[model samples]
Target: MFVQFFYMLRERGVPVTPTSFLRLQKALSLGVIGSIDDFYTAARSILVKSERYFDTYDQVFAHYFRGATILEMEDVELTDIAKALLEEWLKHPQEMAEALGLDEEQLSRYTPEELIRYFLDRLKEQKEAHHGGNRWIGTGGTSPVGHSGDHPGGMRVGGTSRNKSAVKVAMERRYRDYSQEGPLTEIQMSEALKRLRRMIPHGPRDVVNVDKTIYETMRNGGEISIVFDRRLSDRLKVILMIDNGGWSMDPYIGIVQTLFNYARSQFKDLKIYYFHNTLYSSIWLDPQRHLRPEAIEEFTRRDPETRLIIVGDAAMAPYELTGANAAIYVGQKESRTSEERLKFLARTFRHAVWLNPQPESSWGYTWTIGAIWKIFPMFELTLDGLEKAVQHLMKRH
Candidate 1:
């Protein structure tokens, strides 16, 4: 049973090593498997390491072990249970009222679903209100009811007018009003606030401090002196490779922005390349460029001091990392051969660190992640990991 469970976890992408499997077996042998909840607790303790892994484990456990009856039950059945629970409380209305410190009249006024729906509805309404009016188009500060504007055939409000020509005029008027930059609607305002918040720095050290550290390292010819000297001499170039999509966007964006800021202040000779998936045979410095036959040769001749930092979730199509692969998205048209590019990148970089938001355990099923892991040092997207990478780079220098 334990072996089956381990296999199930492996199927679900949890990284269960042979050593871990043995430990789990040992734990299970010592204990009497009493309850389902107890088993779940033991399994989680032995198997799960990261928050991302825990989430996947919960999902897989539910799919594999949750009872059929539990799975089959719909919200209606839950509603029935809620109703029964409510009724039981109603029977002891005086005691319930006293315990809740609520008046009998107030308690009688609402049903279970009614109370739930009331709060849900209130929340929905509040969200809508926060976002401002929902009408997609506007009519020159006037309520969307018909209004005339200066146009050849005059504007028709709301519906299409008798003259098809007038429809264009109406659309022009609507577009004009819609494009105006008034006080942003609730949603726009909220998003703007979020962006502003994201831009604010959180770390103890500012970019100036980072620059100072680099400068100090350069001044001292011990370790970091070599890195700076190589960078200045063009013997080494830092290539910051970032993943710009999916679940990694938020954390990677923050990490990249911070690093970019630091680099801008500290190192002026660095080159950064951004890619979504694995690097193929021919990688262009600028992805928008058409890759020529000589692109790979030209890239190799540069001999840049490459310190590659790959930030991603590392979850992609399995073939993306294994077997024969081509450029992601752009087929053979102007893209590089994927496998060759990745190999070249690995060979070129002096130090390569892969920052993954999905954690190490989640890398089990992802072929691409495992492939990248073999080539680059993989670390969780945490402050400690970032600091460790920085320290490693500093030591390398």
Candidate 2:
């Protein structure tokens, strides 16, 4: 099994050397590799020397084991009875306003708080199978609840989403086949990333040498002696989320990784997290995206001073951004939509901006891009865009 695993990694272009393989095997023999997870960590540490190969190593490992698919989709069945009931329930537009003791005119003028309260109140009253009717749990209604419907400020239930209306999207994503196929140079990319730098002064360090300087000045008599002071640099604490693994983003993977590597070198206090298509529940730090699972709230606790930069095209299917459906990886259930997650993140991070790799003209054509732009002032991936994004973050900060 181990020998075949070595051959598989080599075939996958993992640069696995005999020395590295022997080291891994020796570690396993010494009872160091206790579990599957431990074995993976050990093997990768030994065999994979470059960070760029981590994703490929993970894919090869999973392929050999027949494990979870990267962007796997599964079909969830709805019963014929349930489907019929849903269709039957879709007949009337629910009088959602009346259910909460307000009419259409009054509800339209309702304050944000009032609307929330009204929705909550109506939710408490709903008990039976409802459809297009104004008062029941059903479809095609004016009610703030239920889907495939129309209502001002309606809270849509399961169905086609308000793709045009969503204000945000989670920023992290995936990389399908981790191959840096381009001839891009890190030096050039890092130089471009320099546009995003925040050159504020780092906090003061070490005591001043006033006494020594004075003594030296006195000894020199005519001229004042100078003490060389260390220069101050802006110490930035940044949380960077990179969206990867989409067909639309295939051309920009190298661009994204280059930016990532550059950011790591530039921001000493940078914290990186990853996600796919959309952020439903969490973000990850590892290429496998399982070893370091970070909850949504984890981002909120980051220092408010930390500038949160999200890099992605922000182009994806509408369902990935809105509704209750985990459309990409089916059978996964998330209480909040991708839109809600982005809203939370924006509100939580005081300084945040999105850097989009796609051209500005293409943004209007993609529903998801337009949706995200509403919440974040997105900039193009060029130097000017990065400058604009940095300037915005600075101004907001």
Candidate 3:
């Protein structure tokens, strides 16, 4: 019965597998789904593995269960009556509300099912655009449906938010870009980085050691004897170097900085530094690059096990990375070229991953991006990319 629904979910990129569908079938057969809300909750729990895809799931569910052929406010071609009604409603919204007998208290009383039913009824009855009236899919006033309206319940059809009280947004999907495979947020980045944590025993033995307890108990003629061992603590050391130079990097500065600050607070031995375009002799302590620069050798001298995460667009002039022009080292004598510095950093760290803010698809189009990518395992600065990078680093660990 739900074969079409299952296929629709898959077509919409919800990643619904056959096995999970069978499980859902079994669940339905067992009489678990009692209502539309129950079905939504249960189907999502069974089919959707990640919360990021909840928006897509909601869209699919609404399309399948709720009336799908309803025209949004924008899609409705304005008839003469609709145009006249819109003008009249806009001129006197308060008077129109009194005439329509619609208010916030009445709208607030609607349950989700009632709201959906009301929306479908409104769609069936409303054949044109509504501007400021209540009880129709339109803009302004206290409608349970439509955008820029004040409503405590019902679906938002189209247009920008004004009241922020839509039970379900029937507009364009808001979280389309928030899939697990999409771009990175600070929280997602932090969660991906957390997977890199390696816990080892440290400090005092405050907790009971199970293995030791079992061994000692067996040796002591089965007497119950407790053993305490050192608590396991995070031993992961990370050095985050971000590219914060040039106009090309301005867009990525905020998110990258947020991740850096989060990492500094999260990991015990995390060191963060900033660089411009490409790695040179010195890495900066601040974003403005005004403070005294720290030598790159300081990080290079660290233990080889230290993981390095380099966040940059890597979209710079080839000369900036390749050529040792006078600007990079004019009067001062330097032993290493930019390429050599990159190579040295890559080799020094046992596990290093380069996170390019530019999408991976465009990596091949840029020259400098390709050059840097050769030296490190480069991945896009996205949730999927970060997770893959973490997996790569974990494999080495």
Candidate 4:
């Protein structure tokens, strides 16, 4: 089994070595792994040298084992009663919502910590179903701990999510195959941005000018005179606008997240915002699309020289962008259409580029992709694509 697992990783382009495999075997023999989870963690640590190969490793591991249980049956504390409640709510969601007069405004919000505590407490204490109330472990009410209801900050126990407001999900699989492909790791993305960092330098003369000092010393007859200059602090203000609200972007979320996480730490002045389909009236700070969104004007008002990197497939109906079909944010309409908004963004940010996860070959097949490509320089979201995009941004910088 172990030998098969080793060969599977290599076959899948993971670059697994014999030394690493032997180390994994040694660890297993020494009883370093007690549970399946422990073995997985230990094997990953021993076998995978780079995070770039982690996704391949995970796929190989899953294939070799047929399937690995994330949580053992005995380890889970959920009861059959909870399962029954989920089913009941799913069957009669609308009926329960109407009976309770359950509206989002009536719901009370709870902190994540409070929600967890309350959810666990109610799970243990409550023995019967209670409907349409603020404080119970039942459905269709203002309670911060149940499904088929409204709570701005709550724990979703079970059932289909109405609004994406739940702070934490207890157990569910609403979306399919969300596992990351891990195309771009943090290190790779950060290295690409490092080129941009080299271009922009501002504020504080902290770094010593070594060549200038030596030249000055020679001019002053061997008397040492040091010169100081501004250190290259990352003064490159960047606005990362990502489209994560649709299913098309689900697969690329891993690469997007890697870029976002690295860009957050890489740039001194960086602001991240989320949008759906295309640029509209407003953009959200949270990926869940729950939080109050900021006006598009707020972002455009920033430094015009700020590098704008838009990450999306740009695959949408032409009507969605051309204003033949209205695309509003949070029920509020904008004076400008989506296409107009895209034009305005291009004009506002002097330096902007679009990073499309969709392959460059298939880009021409999508009408919206070509439409947006004309407005902004579009590049693939791979490592090579990122390097090219960075180079384009630097030219404008």
Highest TM-score scorer:
3
What is candidate 2's CA lDDT for residue 140?
28
| 64-124 per-residue lDDT for model 3 (tens digits) | 7664542222222222233345447546646544544667466457553354334433543
Cα-based lDDT for every prediction: 0.49, 0.63, 0.67, 0.67
Model 2 C-alpha RMSD to native: 20.6
Decoy 1 TM-score against native? 0.37
Over 94-159, each residue of candidate 4 has an lDDT whose tens digit, in order, gives 543443355423323533234333443455444334423433111123333213221111232324
**Candidate 3 similarity to native, TM-score:** 0.61
Decoy 2 TM-score against native:
0.47
Question: Which is superior by TM-score, 1 or 3?
Answer: 3
lDDT of 1 by residue, 113-144 (tens): 35444433343354344322211121123222
Candidate 2 deviant stretches above 4 angstroms: 1-189, 195-231
Cα displacement (angstroms), candidate 1, residue 37, comes to: 45
Q: Model 3 scores what on Cα lDDT?
A: 0.67
Q: In model 3, how large is the Cα lDDT of residue 114? A: 52
